[model samples]
Target: MLGKTASDNRVFVYEVAGVRQNTDNDKNSYPFRSSSSVFIKVPYQRMNDEMRRITRMGGTILSIKPWTSNNGSGEQSNDGD
Candidate 1:
């Protein structure tokens, strides 16, 4: 999965295997920031579908981050970057 942060600070996660579309406000219900741009995750299988759905809904993807699993396992944060 891929995660993107919109201008409104709302994060959207997608399967990275879909399409991107452009449509009106017919399927939009949530509030999104005005300066939103679509970010896509490539090198995946069938990512066009997810991209299309997000664009059609009038939302933009900002970034993509690696997915992690937190099953109550204690983890440490490293700030050595």
Candidate 2:
């Protein structure tokens, strides 16, 4: 993990809905199909590939957004003014 900074890691959150379970995806065992939308975390490198895969499995992406799970204990702190 040398020379790796926090900014170097790229991740995205995909809010997808209407995922259809079919033969091709059945083999892959995608068990996130439901009536509601699901959150899928995709790396930057596999963004396009994952999108294609989802589409192939009959999924509609509701939205795509850059995500980072640094909500607490990151670099920000509240100093009493």
Candidate 3:
């Protein structure tokens, strides 16, 4: 299970399956600042489906990265978002 914390201190869980850098930096500065790692967050249940899609698209699943908040306790409320 995942825990929630403050906005800045919140850890984002993502999968670094594959990445494509934007080389068209000359067109805009957005590409340069955004041309690092790609983090996509999906629900836990959808992980399997996402993995299948990535594999089908010829991308390799690197690893499952889970980030836990430092200040967050191991308690999460399921009151619906």
Q: Positional deviation of 77 in candidate 1, in angstroms?
A: 25
Q: Highest TM-score: which candidate?
A: 2
- Writing each residue's lDDT as its tens digit, candidate 2 over 1-81 gives 578765457767777887777876677533545566767777676778878877987889898877766622222111111
Q: Could you tell me which residue pairs clash in candidate 3? A: none
TM-scores for every predicted model = 0.32, 0.67, 0.39
Rank the candidate models, highest lDDT first: 2, 3, 1
lDDT of 3: 0.44
Local lDDT at 58 for model 1:
52
Highest lDDT scorer: 2
- Global local distance difference test of model 2: 0.65
Q: How many backbone clashes does every candidate have?
A: 15, 0, 0
- Candidate 1's error at 78, in angstroms? 30
lDDT (tens digit, per residue) of candidate 1 on 22-53? 35433445443333242333323334555555
RMSD of 3: 10.5
Model 1, residue 69: what's the lDDT?
Answer: 48
